[model samples]
Target: MGGESNRSLSLLHESQNKINSSKDVFLEKCL
Candidate 1:
């Protein structure tokens, strides 16, 4: 159960990073 939670956390972190980077790029373009 702990291992499964850890994997989920990492996947979430990765997806968050991807979303943040994409947002940064979009804001840069807008500016």
Candidate 2:
């Protein structure tokens, strides 16, 4: 019942979160 889609969605969400975290770290270092 759409388990594969859910898995991919979660993976994408995690990757987006990682990108956001890295961006935040870079901004903090720049400040």
Candidate 3:
């Protein structure tokens, strides 16, 4: 159970990073 929770956390973090990077790209285009 502990291992599964850790895996889920990492996946969430990865997705969060992807969202942030996409936001940055959108901002650059707006400029």
Candidate 4:
């Protein structure tokens, strides 16, 4: 159970980083 939770947490963090990078690219294009 603990390992499963850690895996999901890492996945969530990875997705969050992708979202943040995409947002940065979008802002750059808007400017």
lDDT by residue for model 1 (1-31), tens? 9999999999999999999999999999999
Q: What tens-digit string does per-residue lDDT give for candidate 3 at 1-31?
A: 9999999999999999999999999999999
Q: What's the lDDT for candidate 4?
A: 1.00
Per-candidate TM-score against the hidden true structure: 0.87, 0.92, 0.93, 0.93
Candidate 1, residue 9: CA error in Å? 0.3
lDDT for residue 11 in candidate 3, whole number 0-100: 100
For candidate 3, the TM-score is 0.93
- lDDT tens digits, residues 1-31, model 2? 5999999999999999999999999999999
Q: Which residue pairs overlap in candidate 4's backbone?
A: none
Clashing pairs in 2: none
Better of 2 and 3 by lDDT: 3
lDDT of 4 at 1: 100
Off by over 4 Å in 2: none
List where candidate 1 sits over 4 angstroms from the true fold: none
